[model samples]
Target: MMDALFITLQVILAVIAVYQFVFSLFGMYRKKKKAHFPATKSFAVLVAAHNEEQVVGALMENLKNLDYPKELYDVFVICDNCTDGTADIVREHGIQACVRTNTNLRGKGYAIEWMLKELWDMPRQYDAVVMFDADNLAAPNFLSEMNDDLSGGARVIQGYIDTKNPEDSWITAAYGISYWYINRLWQLSRHNVNMANFLGGTGMCFETKMLKEIGWGATSLVEDLEFTMRSVQKGIYPKFNYDAKVFDEKPLTFKASSRQRLRWMQGHFTVARRYFFPLLWQSIKERNLVKFDLALYSVNVYIVLLTFLMTAIMGIDAAVFNGPNIANIYGYLPLGLSFVAVGASILTFMAAMALEKVTFKKVYAYLILFPIYLISWYPITFYAFFTQNNKQWSHTEHTRVVRLEEVVQSKQV
Candidate 1:
């Protein structure tokens, strides 16, 4: 019975691993046909902020200087429950700042919903709505690329997310490495195979009519994910635009990163529980492969928990329990496969770094410790599962004030 149980767990994990591995194979081929379109779509750029006085000005400057025409896009900042000078800063840039003071209805999703209603009531009509966090620095060509994508009939779009302070600390470096890996292997790979692209909280765009039709109902901690699942149910797949880039500020310390990820996982658990069955049923009813893929994607945190549980059971049984003495190599299959998975992850990280032109010397120490950061997710997943009922939103403070020019110049070096 013991041997059989071990084998069962091993097989389950192996299947999940294989599923992810197969999808990753598609990431290597990222050649997308380009459609040339005139820049005609008008965009209402929305920035949601909670006391982001320090970095909001920089983002304002970045937005003001977008390579796209000035008449084509307008910027609006939603200052939600902020006691700081964020509104003043927006006014300083001559941009309209919308303030919201609802303590009960907080979080980015609620703020977005409020702003969307306001935009809908206003006289100015926009073709599409672009969302960004106040800490982000948009690429000069960000709006132009998004315009092209909108013209190509993509109702929702997610741009490439780049790191601003990758070399700030080990934690930031690890975050940068993780984002780079997922952007290429996960997002680009899914897009390559015609799968749906998940929306990053920042760098996301939605067509005005489509968003209104879907309704701004996603108000969870991870609104981007919640909205993505909601869109998938309606057969709306967000397109990934590699040419459009947005530089995001990463937490510089482990404590900050931990808080951020815990909130994310907890929100992930909430989303999974709420949407798992609905997505699976929709997929079967409609025979939509994208919905099926999303159903699996929704339970990614549970997969992590399962991995941790299996590793613990295998280790405890082999060392402390010592109940099974099968003496067969099959008992060690999980261990062998784990080592292979780690090796593959390292290779994936190296490849991602190379593609992003990150020098080994600059990030070698952080790269060495990346596995440790990855392993930390197990405990976080467990904690998040237990505390999944807590829907309180905690803010991750972003203080790195890097300019768009500085980021672009560093990449060119």
Candidate 2:
């Protein structure tokens, strides 16, 4: 019975691994050259902040210098539950700031929903709405690239996620590397294969009509993932725009990073539970590849758990059962395959870094530290699985005050 159970589990894991491996290969497709278009669509840029007085000003300054037409895009800062000078700073910059003091319905998702209602009530109309965190810095061509994406028939678009302070600490560097890897392997791959792309909280643009059609009711901790899943359910797939870059601040310490990831995993599991079955049924009923892919992606956390279970099971079988096991049956083949997997991962990371124009020498230490950082996610995700009901938002404090020019200069180097 145990042998049969082991084989069943191994088969399940092998299939899942093969699926992801195929998707990773899809990322190797050449990047589509982005075409510039006239800034025809007007955008209402929304920045949700919670006492983000330190970095909000820098974002406002960066928004002011966007390469897109000044009259075409308007910036609004939603100062959600802020007891600081965030609103004052926005007003000082000659921009509008919408302040919300609702302690009960806090968080970026609620703030966005509230602000959307306010925007809809106004006589002014916008073609789309773009979201950004208070600590993010947009490249000058950010809006322009989004405009091109819209012109190219992408209704909902996710801009490229870049790191503002990758060299700040090991935690930040790991986050940076992870984002780079996801951008190339996950986002770009999905884009190439016409699969659904995910919104990275910030740097996401939603057409006003799409927003009204779907309604931004994603009030989960990871509202971005919830919204993406909801949109997929409604037959809207977000497009990934590699040309549009948005620089975001990452957590500096492992504790801070783990807490943020825990919140994300909790939300991830919640979303998967809510949507997995529906997506699976939808995929089967409609014979939709997009829905099927999304359904599989939703349960990725479970796959991680299954991987841990497999390792534990193998260890138990070797220890408790004693003598040579299935692993030894293959002799050095298992060990050789492990080396191959490690080598493949290293090559993939190198490719991601090179494509993102990151200086490898500068981030070499972080590369060595990445295995520990990646391993930490397992414990965080495991804890988050049990405590998924805890919806309390633990915000990561961002104090990195880097400017857009500095980021741009560093990239050029």
Candidate 3:
């Protein structure tokens, strides 16, 4: 009975994982027609900076040269409790800067909340608000695409996120690969079906009315996911803009990337705990498949950790029951389920590369390390699940200055 129960549990996880994998596979075939909208909405660009002196100025410069009417958009920078020259740099460029000083209210969520309130009190109201990190460089036509989308009637939108220094280290390479995979396989797949897209922390836009209605109440470490999952309950879906590209600076070292990913894992699990049950119940009660999809996607970290734990328990049983010189259960047990998931992941990334025509030798070389990076997530997920309360946000340092032109040329790889 014990063995049967364990086998049944593994079978359940394998089923859910396989279902998600198949959906992702199905999402690869994007057939939806994109309706172009006129470019006319006014936007307020928001940047929340914390000691980002190294790269904030470059971001402002990139904004000033965007291919859109100057009058259509304005930039705002929030130097949140920075003891550095981030504020000075913003002021030197004659940009609107807000210096926040409340130490208790830390992280990007608080900074965004403060800025939204400030924007609300201003004399002129913006039709939409777009967000970017201090280290991000916008593609010259990013705003134009966003403007087109906003004019066409998409209320909330997440732009494409690319990396700046993909060749800086193996970690950066893996990070870049992860983004491209998610961008092509995950977001585009959802968009292909006219479903909601998940918002990254940066390179996203929200309608002014939506922001006012919901407020930036998602103060978790991963504010973007928090906001996306919570807001879907109200039937408002976020859309995607494939052309609005923003090059983000990825961490160049494992230690740095681990800390950054740890926060993400912690925040993902935390938000899942709070919203998954309610959202799942609502999805079934109302027959809303979009919300159901979002609920399943949000709990991915938990699913992975659970898989490892169940596999571990099986190993323990193999040891205790077999006594001395116990035989391995690699073939008999469902450990192959994990490998199947990993194989599906590799195929997903390879397919994304093919879709983008990424034949670059260096990118292919870097992609070989993706399985290693994917496996490392298991340890980090376990660590984060046990230690989620130490939520003092750790900011990933960024100093790379790669621009959109490099991204366009395909030489950054």
TM-score for all predictions? Answer: 0.95, 0.94, 0.92
- Candidate 1: minimum summed lDDT over ten consecutive residues — where? 323-332
**Tens digit of lDDT per residue, candidate 3, span 217-250?**
9888999999998789888889988778888999
Off by over 4 Å in 2: 316-334
Q: Please report how far candidate 3 places residue 70 from its true position, in Å.
A: 0.7
Question: Model 1 off-target regions past 4 Å?
Answer: 1-6, 323-339
Candidate 3: where are CA atoms >4 Å away? 1-5, 30-33, 316-342, 411-413
lDDT of each: 0.88, 0.87, 0.84
Clash-forming residue pairs, model 2: none
lDDT digits (tens) for residues 1-413 of candidate 2: 76666667777776777687778777776565657787899999999899899999999999999988899999999999999899999999999999998988877888899999999998889999999999999989888888888888888999999899988898888988999989988899899888999899999998999898879999999999899899999999999988789999999899889889999999899999999999999999999999999898888888777767667667787799883465432244578887786787678877877776687455667788988998887778888889999988777888899998898777677
TM-score of 2: 0.94
Higher-ranked by lDDT: 1 or 3: 1
Q: Write the per-residue lDDT of candidate 1 for residues 1-413, one digit (tens) a residue.
A: 86677667667667777788778767776685788688899999999999999999999999999998899899999999999999999999999999999999889999999999999999999999999999999998888899998888899999999888888889888988888888988898999878999999999999999988879899999999999999988889988998899999999888898999999999999999999999999989989889988998998889899878777766776798784553333455688776887788678777877775775354567777888789999999999999989988998887889998787777666
* Candidate 3 global Cα RMSD: 2.8
Model 3 residue 149 CA deviation in Å: 2.1
Ranking by lDDT: 1, 2, 3
> Which candidate model has the greater lDDT, 1 or 2?
1
